[model samples]
Target: MGTDVNRKAKHILIVGGGYVGLYTALRLQRRLSRELRDGSVRITLATPESYMTYQPFLPEAAAGNLSPRHVVAPLRRVLPKVRIINGKITKVNHAAKTATFQPADGPRRDIAYDIIVMAAGSISRTLPIPGLTDIGIGFRTVGEAIGLRNRVLHQLDVAESVDDPDLRRRALTFVVVGAGFAGVEALAELEDMSRDSIRYYRNLSPRDLRWVLVEATDRVLPEVGPEMGRWTLEQLRERGIDVRLNTRLESCVGGKVVLSDGDVFEADTLVWTAGVRANPIIESSDLPIDERGRIKTTTWLTVAGVRDAFAAGDIAGVPDATNPGRFCAPNAQHAVRQAKVLADNIVRTLRGEELVGYRHRYVGSVAGLGLHKGVANVYGIKLRGFPAWFMHRTYHLSRMPTFNRKVRVVVDWTLALLFKRETISLGEIHHPRDEFRAAVATGRKH
Candidate 1:
């Protein structure tokens, strides 16, 4: 039976709490009319995390320039009216109007809804390289950022105390496999942090650390134009970063990284930021998907031939109205803008109004290569050095979700300028139970 217009309230179910899901709900919550707001609609958002991570700041977070907690918007705190479920939606039974979800601590359960928003964003795209799973870490979430920082600092501690040459070398070497914004920013920021941190350790010096970046394609920072890309390469190389162009990481077996360029080396840390694919959950859903496994949506951000279903962000292939033949790029700018359109369209659909198409022109790209260094090209205006770096900070700071978060991020930057970057690594945070387990085992042996 259809949603009873007279008695039952319409339920809006959002599958993921990332950029699209969170923003769409926020818009809808604010724009809904007084009558509908009272009790006509119920918005339920189900996500793996209770917070939405501002991913662009992950590099700075890793370098301890910003607090990891401040980089995420807690859904419960931000969206008080929306029902937030700390669970993952495993499958969507659209035909039956039911969705199955498994909570972190409970068995699978199903919920019925009148509308479904498929905003289940992307996951790390990994290759089947040997030992990759055992050694590699991704740079997608706040947890990964924190863990990487801890591991990097911990490795320095190990290198300082270890006397074995091979062990020391392995501990000192750091490899990042990707050259996009995520990879480049992460490498630069972490390198800067590590260099500054080395002064505290008398045994370690700047020269002792080796930072390597491997990209499968010809150049790094492809989002930025060629000129800025070249400038980024030169800047990174000048700072002692090994930028391996046209190179691929074949295998990372036993901590030894085998590259396509015939180079093999042992490294203690391997960060995989190569790329991302749509969330695998979409594949199982009965939706029309593109070749890359993204849900096929019209320019208006609605799933083609599906009623009361909408999608956007990295998971949906919405054709770009501005660029006739192509789809919108999977980036924060597009995701945020498309969410606005998607939200408005949802409202329009409810009001029986015409939906508008999603259209956005390619703005520009920017990358920060450590502190006081960056590259950018905004509306054909090229820039590099500290100017670009300032632009990077300015743009992201303004676009950060909430005003509170924006203020906090500014406070972080201001404090960073006044004080020094924090260098302490809480590696044990990830394995808090390990030491307790070890002690229990020791007592049993005794």
Candidate 2:
């Protein structure tokens, strides 16, 4: 009877191995001493990738300041005690305490869990625009970031080799939709890289390149206050970047961008980093969610109307304790902090201890505007240029997961200081199957 009961260990299954999932599991694995040793509790983490991407480093990665591998932490290495299942949870039945998981190449399977942590994160929230599918690329994943870097460099090469004015003009132009941190940082980094790489090509110069940032809002970097936003706009404009404020992308058909403000332009590259929506998997779950499709949670981060079900990070609509009638903004700072509190509360629930509410005030924002230039607003004190740039790097370096990853990223930065940033475009990395397809065709012909 004792063995039978022990065999039925309470399984804590966490979906999405992003910020919340990794941090929560790290805490639980360290805290679940007696429960784990006696087989009374077990933790499992399910995610599409075996690694977690440190999204803040994406801009730096694209600029080749940090290697792509250093920005991602492998789940297996980080969460050794927890069962790392490489899959995605398609649906959740909280009433039954079971979830349906689909592996990369395997059939669907039902996983029973005593506790569920919904941290599936968010996906790029895009609008319905013509040719968006064909011409636009998102800046959410590491693959996308690296691909964008290669594509930008390849366009430089294309412009240098081509004689046609139309082709050269299209190849040299780059359009970025959105003025958020991701969009702005990506644009700045890529543009800086292109500027540095201009001397390598005889036909391509800084004048031949056109980088445009389109934002529907009147100001950019709204997280950094209106004053700072305007300062950033002026800085970008001074750097010859076209900052289109209060503008929206009407269409992007065949490398032609039609703006809502009666402007039309041709560009070969269109990067979309407008916004993100909560993972759609939350809707399929039998849990209380807000109108925005995020799991409705109390201040303590427990799922409302559901027992043993909790959520944090982007997927959880956690009430803002500091401000009533509002929810916490979905950002990395809140996500990482909430994961810690949520883990403690989960342990408290198991021990029948009191739970504490989660509350955090907005602590301002920081952004990098190309190399050695940035903007920051922390505790109402504003900073710009190299000081903000150093703060941006220092802050993210400290937040990056694992000592090993930190060392690797620092090494990449150190090497960059000693050597110039590599500008070669390895475009074939994305099309790994092309060689196989060509080989198959030749074999059939023979």
Candidate 3:
């Protein structure tokens, strides 16, 4: 009877490569090593990228304080026992126990599995303001962070080289929408980097740059509470950053920013870090989802009213047991912790044991506002300035995926203290084949 129970073969399919997907797989690999070795259990993770990006460090990476490569962990190296597929799980047919996998360079195919983990994370939630799509960029991925860095530095170069005052003014104006963690940190880091870079340019000065932050809400960093948010606002205003609260971006037609307060300006750079919505892939699946489009999950991390299906992270509407009548916030704090519980439950189910529910108290929030500046509220303990900044770094460093990545990030920070931030923009990297194409055309003519 024992051998029969242990010999049962099962396959687990995990979709998405973000925090929940990566961590859950890591935990399951360790828990099911014997089953894997005996060919009684198999795990396959499908993700759009081969590596998992630690989004919390993106701001530092954008400011050139950390290398881009160090912010992401290669999934293959971390999960050697699991099968990694570089693709997207386009759709999940739970009734049929199969998911449609669309590989990076091939036709779509169906993957059969005994259990499915819907870890497909959220995407940037965008609005339909005029010219917003054309002019705006987001700060979710490492590419966007590094790209925004290049764009900012490139704009400075344009401003310096141009003789037209209007063009130069437009080039120097940077507008960031939303005052959440992403928007605030991104604005602060880039502004700090740009301020440091101005000393090298003879024509540009700190006064020449205009940094504007637009938000519809009356406060910033709502996660840290109103008092700390107010403090953060004051700090930014003191740094000459224009913080517009309770205001809406009416439009940005032809680079002309028309605000709800009748303010008008031309800005070449517009960053939209407002929010994110659950991945549309959830809609394609047969899983039951809430009105917000997130898969409804029980405290045990299992999909509501569905057998052999589980979900966690930003894509799941997981009820917060700690806060009655509320769901868990879509953040790294919940995702990381929930993943451990999720993995353990899966192991329990395989062993015919009782599953465990996931519950954890909200620890609080921490945010970095450039070098030696930050705000944090941990367990109701409020902190600001250098102390908060140090706490933010230490907490995130402790959470950063692997020890290998943690060491690289520390080295990057140490080097930044010894050297000035590099402001050179390698924009040509976005179009590497352009020069080769031009050469080919010349060769054909010759």
Candidate 4:
């Protein structure tokens, strides 16, 4: 039975609400509204959240410069014409042309659509490091950002207490592993925030804080060249950050971190921004995937050997044509650009036109180190310090999707210029449980 073209519009279901999914839907609404209105196409975007978080700003969110909510865009507002179904896809029955999803509120619902776009983005890649789930916090989502902010400030609070040097050292020490964009930005931002916050707590000083960054690789930000990584290392070390290259984190017990470099460091806070893996949604689906579990897609964003199905972003192993037997590197720039190509390809497929593949050579790489500092390499040029920082903000703000959001972010920056940054900590949110328990105990005793 072919798709019923006489009924409601031909359904195009997009899974995952991250950069690729949301942008593709937005482009569809902007370009294909006529098709949707004339009963030619019906578009629906099914994602776990109603927003797409611009991940580049997440480290700044952890640092408290950008509001976590501001980092994400509400899908309904951007693509109001498209149906926004909030759910996490568990199974994709491509043969049946249907996908099973567990909604945010309701029971699992099986949705049938004529076409599907698997843009399910990546998840925080974590290893089975002992005591990680219980003692460590991830740096992926807005929730994790908030949690890290709370945890960092809470560590300060713990350090401000009574006279046990051992305990104080543990409270003040913060261990961060991985030197990629996420790790470097996070370490720099959090360290800057915590250092500034010490003024509010008289007992905690900048010297008391021991921030360590461990990277198994020889240097940080492999996306950038080694020269830039060395420059970043210089900048970080200048700010008193201990950047350990060619070092591995052997294990992290209750709070103490053991490095393969034979250094045993004790700390109360351990943040893992190591890396990310493709979304597990692929494994559940009856789709062909590469060894890395990414759906093998052709140059035009079409899944190999699959009909009317497409994928992009971190989840799809797009063949990097230039590098034989290799896939396109996963990053935000590709995800954003790939969305346009993917949307165009889908439209072309609908109209029986020829499709083009997605190919974007990395234009540049940039990283923000707390306030007023950064590094970048664009179009064969490398920059550092204030200029790179300015470029970073300008590029991201321009590419931040909506004008409304861009204005808000720019305004935030302006206000920051006029007023000193706010370093007040909101660390008590995590200790409410302990307070409640203590209150209950006191009442029972009385």
Candidate 5:
């Protein structure tokens, strides 16, 4: 079967630029190349950013082991045939076959499409903890990762410059809430970076810095199973990291962190990797969503009972065909694979052929704990320390979008082995306009 040549042109609108959007569109570009060239099928990808961030590398990016730029692939470059819109689809009116497109700047407009792919991925799931909005930072984006790195290094500088004991103590303490893959890896990597940086500081030592990991649950890396999780917990504790399990962050009003265990301390830096929720933008769409606000999707990766509409990744509650009574876990592993099936299914739909369902066995999990440290349980085989770390890097490097980024990341890693990791803080980049504003104020005063 093939696409009907007599039918009208079809437009495929893809929402979000994460794994699902990028991979699906890339596949469609190849699968429907003839249609795209003939103007019979059009693909438009609308996302907040022009680049798709490879989130797994975010921890290494924060640790200065990978360049921030290398952690993302430009959407335009990757999908040359697909029209890339550096904006967001604010609302989806599937009944009307139109979506509200809100650009990074300027007025909103409605776009018409024959089919829509809901890939508007998840966002940092924050809590109502006091002062969290004022003080805490998430580890989701490249900006946040790099900003946390600068904040950590800047805290070191603050400790070195200050003579007050109380202030120094606060400056040296770093707290991370959540011991999941993101939380643990981020804490471990930054701690390793800070420890390496201590040798360059005159008044600082590794002992002076306090690193804490607080998880509401009793274990870490739950996806890797209890055995590997317990092993990982032991490894972290052995590195002098304060792993506080069964603890919730009661409050962080001011820099004072109050834990559920009745422990209170002042920390200058607080990193929140607690969790992520589906992008609330999904609420505006007229689609069937699950209890968690994720769009309901079938095993074929199509929106449940909604023809010509698809969803995958964190935004979709796609049922696991391999595992009954459960949905696929929201991870890169599943997202990447689902995209392939999703793209193939779309082509099948276009050709008036039977669509295929997505089904894959759980391959296990892998997570990095700073340089030369990691844990992995792929295909029921367990590995720890350098082997795990090597596997983590190798697996992620291969999965990273585009060969250019993969080579750049490898070069960054290669350079790290030959030289020391750069610990310089560029916090000023966060407030670049501050210097200009100060100059204007000075001129007014003069």
Candidate 6:
């Protein structure tokens, strides 16, 4: 949608820049370039950022195993023909077939579109738990991953410098709330990295480090089945990880985690990765949403009751045909598969071809347990330890989208096999403005 245009090839406006949005855009970009009848198909992707952060690599980014910069794709670079606007869609008027947007640095604007794809993704689902707003670190973004790394490294410094045992203990203890992929893998990878890092620091040993995982549910990685969940728990327990299942973080006033199980632990780090809810922006849009606040979509990925509107990913509650009883789970695998289907459906609608329904079975789940240990259950086959870990890397690498990116990621892994993991922390970048302000204030005083 733009200032003036005879709608050519039926303009496609994709909202959101996360998994579903990016994948859909990528596929559409290639398809449009190669297959479109007359370049009549105009694609525009509008989102808050001109980049897409690969969420799956956040754990590796947190552990400093992968550079955070390597986990993002610049939208403009990947899809040159596609108009990439840095903005957020504030309203969607399906009746008029238009969306209102607020740009990064301009007046508000309206976009009239022929077709709309709402992939506005999910946000970190947070509760009003005491002190969570200020203390809990989210596990959804690359920035948070880099921040967590700095905090972990600095915590090691705190442990080394402090003479008080209690202070050292508090600094060394890292608490992660949530046993999902983000929390579990982050805890595992960081713990593994930190344990390896102790050789450089004479004051701390692997035994001195405390890694705690607290989950409200009775098990971790529930998608991997009860057996796998139980097995994963045992593995964590065997590594001295204090996994508190059927427990909740009641309060964390002043870095002390008070659990529902009537136990208390003090730690400087609190990571929140319990789950994600639809992005709050959807609530403001003129569309029907489910009880959980997700856009309801049919088997064909069209907005359940709205014509010309389609959505996919975490924000869209897409009905699962294979299961027939539930919505598609908001995981990377589903999101990737749904994007392809959603893109094809959009193109189909433009070409006057019949839109096909989205149908795919759950292809099992995988978890990387750090330092070359892993767990996975794919197509009814279960794997654990090194085998599972190898599969985990392989699956994610293969599914990493572009062939160019795939090669770069594989190169990173190959280099990692030969060289030691980089433990350098870039904490300074987080507070560049603060340092400038302080320097200016001090200069005035002088």
Q: Provide TM-scores for the models.
A: 0.97, 0.97, 0.97, 0.94, 0.97, 0.96
Displacement of the residue 232 alpha carbon in candidate 1, Å: 0.3
Give one digit per residue, the lDDT tens place, for model 3 in 1-446. Answer: 01112224698999999999999999999999999999899999999999999999999999999999999999999999999999888888899888888888868788888888989899999888999998999999998999999999999999999999999999999999999999999999999999998888999999999999999999999999999999999999999999999999989988999999999999999999999999999889899999888999999999999988999999999999999899999999999999999999999988889999989899999999998899999999999999999999999999999999999999999998898888899888878999999999999999
- Candidate 6, pairs of clashing residues: 9-40
- Model 5 per-residue lDDT tens digits across residues 1-446: 11212226798989999999999999999999999999999998999898999999999999999899999999999999999988878788999888888788878888888888998889989889998987899999999999999999999999999999999999999999999889999999999999999889998888998999999998998988899999999998898999999999989989999999999999978999898999888889899989877999999999998989999999999899998999999999999999999999999998999999999888999999999999999999999999999999999999999999989999999999999889999999999999999999999999
lDDT of 4 by residue, 286-345 (tens): 889987888988888988999989999999989876677778888888899899999999
Error of 1 at 402 (Å): 1.3
Best by lDDT: 3
Task: Report, for every candidate in turn, its global Cα lDDT versus the true structure.
Answer: 0.90, 0.91, 0.94, 0.86, 0.92, 0.86
Give me the runs in candidate 5 sitting further than 4 Å from their true place: 1-8
Worst 10 residues of 3 by lDDT: 1-10
Expressed as tens digits, the lDDT of each residue in 128-180 for candidate 6 is 89988877899888889889988888888889998999999999999999998
The list of candidate 1 runs beyond 4 A from truth reads 1-7, 33-36
lDDT of 1 at 59: 90
Q: Candidate 2 residues 1-446, lDDT tens each?
A: 01112228888989999999999999998999778889888999999999999999999999888899999999999988899998888889989888898889867888888889999999999999998989899998999999999999999999999999989999989999999999999999999999999899987779988999999988899889999989999989998999898899999888789999999889989999999999999878889889988989999899998789999999999999999999999999999999999999989988889989999998988999988999999999899999999999999999999999999998998999899999999999999899999999999999
Cα RMSDs of all predictions? 2.3, 2.6, 3.5, 2.8, 3.4, 1.9
> What would you estimate as the lDDT of candidate 6?
0.86
What lDDT score is found at residue 329 in candidate 5?
92
